[model samples]
Target: MTTPVEPPVPPADTAPPRPGRKLGPIADGVGSVHRAWLEPLRHTYLTSGLTLSDLSIRVPLAKSKISELLRGCGLYPRWEIMHSLSIQLQLPSWPLHRLWRQAAFEAQKSSEWVERSGDKAAVTTSLVPPLDHRAFRETVESDYSLYAQVFLDDDQRDTAVSNAFDILWLRWNEALASPDIRRFAWEALRATVMARTPHIDGRPEFGAAAFDTVALQHLTTETERMDQMAESLHLFKAMSWLPDRQLDVMVMRRLYGTSPEAVSDLLGLSLATVRSDERHANHFLQSVICPTPETEGKTA
Candidate 1:
């Protein structure tokens, strides 16, 4: 009780340009799978939908080649692979086109999330105002560091981090909260990342694929859920109660490990003032606002 992808014909207007150009087999609707094909193909056939029965007889490729190409493999054929399949099946092109677009969108997002993190410096730009520039860099850096440590070797770390990035970026809200901002970041990030890592697939380790996949999926899921529960902007306002200078002091000394002189130069404060401010911020966070959790079972 299922339907299959409809066949597609070349758009009517498709033609070779100019005199002596000669009519060409237009390739429109060639490479992409049509959306009408999604359910039946995915549910029943997977890559096996292109069976070379009498129905598949007229497709350009031989039965064996057709079978090989059914999954939409490594390289896209110069001709419309999907279009031929559609013709063989005698299905309409509309649904197949829709499915192809959907798959393209998903593949784009997946590439963005899993493939870009090998270059940690690429993520530093701020998209808008009211951004906690420090926290953003630190958080992304921490994620990168965690990934680097997870593998500990050059090839493993590089591949795993790249894959992890693509996996994370596809979820949208992990980087930007607003939908428009998310779209913009996703597009820009996708283009740049894909350019940088042309051959990345974002599958870190065969053994940990399931864990890594679920981890990133739920990481963003929880972030969105928690952002809602905590009321993001409201929480931001509440956190702003900490004086900017004290927050700066705590961040430099504790979070950054910057020396007092470096802190003084960065914050435009004197050495004495930097030391005093650090002491004050540390004392306040330790006692009033933030307390260190017990490290009994935690690493040093």
Candidate 2:
């Protein structure tokens, strides 16, 4: 009898449908960072030989609040509260902020994807697409302000995002080895910011003094480079004064050259809402530059 012949295998893409992919590092990293922060808080109490009650007294927080934080109740303290703890514990605020931001980002990303894609199981079960650094950055870059806005003011948020990318590049090798590369880069940056924060005297406060300083730096007949840098810095300081959401919307739409529809998608806003935000942001800036009588009257 002739040997039986088998049909050729189908292309891999034609294989039977599989269940959702594992989210892997996305879920794992978020939880790990949460624990990372909580454990240190608990350790501080332990190493100081203070009970939760005693710690509450020093932190000026309720014992229950301290307990909730220690237990990871999903509510992070405000920066002011963290700052207080940092002072008492001599721990840098940067690490806690960094970890907290990562945790928040991951949680929000998972929730938003589930909502948008209507794939609840995939997100909640940690069964989603295979994520890599480029995909992760693209996913998070749009609403990066969401995670960052929690810890940084509007002006600082853009700077922080830019800085994080730089940090990621500087530590590419180490970051590549991380179970969650994005989280690792962020935490590294947070540590760097915290470490350096103590050495820096102060940041440029948004005020007349800030503008005056910039003006003083301008040459009587500036080179093209100096003029460009001065203009850029002036605009940055001006933009910083806008409301948080407005600033975020403006930065993504203008600086990144993202389209309005794309901006809406990224920011989870309706098309109309995105346009309105941009309009309002621009109006606010224009009003500052050339005050309408109405605005001047309100100011007066």
Candidate 3:
């Protein structure tokens, strides 16, 4: 009798076919999935004890393509390719699917921007930059001193500064990698400060007083200074009530000392829009703080 033939067994680590999981709609933004992919993919590949070449053979994809997936270089693979790899690597479908979606979105966004700007270099690379905490701390700490003068108590200032730095450090690498350096830096610190200050949620009040103090230092008349201070305080308080977009523009202009042109660029708005928002915010504040005769009569 002929020897019975045994069936070929799949590799021991090969993921068995499981019930297919449905993927959720892809999230917007470039790093949405890329950040999620980095750790899980690395850990799974390492645990499988497979080399790059071996993985290519098993997945039946080119080595370069495998490297792209592994590195999350912002190049998305098709759903079929992702499905095949999901089975081969035994990774959770959601992670791979999400990665594919983010990469695809980023690729499309980059393509459109490149067409508009005609500048290939404007497209951001996936390479993460090294963070220099010492440098960042040195630069921000002095600014934080001015910050402390307004909101933070003497004892709480250092602690708040440390905490703010800790929170911002999380996004430091990402900020360094982005093309919009000024806006990224401004936003990172703004977010950190907002998170720490619960009382004035979106108002940039802490530094506003400092800017006002400097600009108003030359006023010799105590009466004039007092009037200005009152007006400033009223405007500052009114900031908490302003619409979100108008508040952003007003704070960037009056508090942060950013020019209207810079505000326009930072906010991705036209100069006219920035100025108009500033005017609207100022008018609203005036209506509340220094009401006209008609508004007073109406209130009466």
Residue range 1-300, candidate 2, lDDT tens digits: 111222343343222332333112212232544555555555454444456555578886887676666666645444455556656765544545555545555455454432343221121222222345457567666456444542345665665665555344434444565444544554643443332222223432333322233344544654754665566565655566666567667766744557787666554455676788899988877676557988866533
Instruction: Give the TM-score ranking, best first.
Output: 3, 2, 1
CA-lDDT, candidates in order: 0.38, 0.51, 0.54
Q: Write candidate 3's Cα lDDT for 67-94 as tens digits.
A: 6666654455555555555566665454
Please give the range of 10 consecutive residues that has the lowest summed lDDT in model 1: 203-212
Worst window of 10 by summed lDDT in candidate 2: 120-129
Looking at model 1, residue 176 earns an lDDT score of 45
Ranking by lDDT: 3, 2, 1
lDDT of 2: 0.51
Q: Name the lDDT value of residue 182 in candidate 1.
A: 21
Worst 10 residues of 3 by lDDT: 1-10
Q: Which candidate number has the best TM-score?
A: 3
TM-score winner between candidates 1 and 2: 2
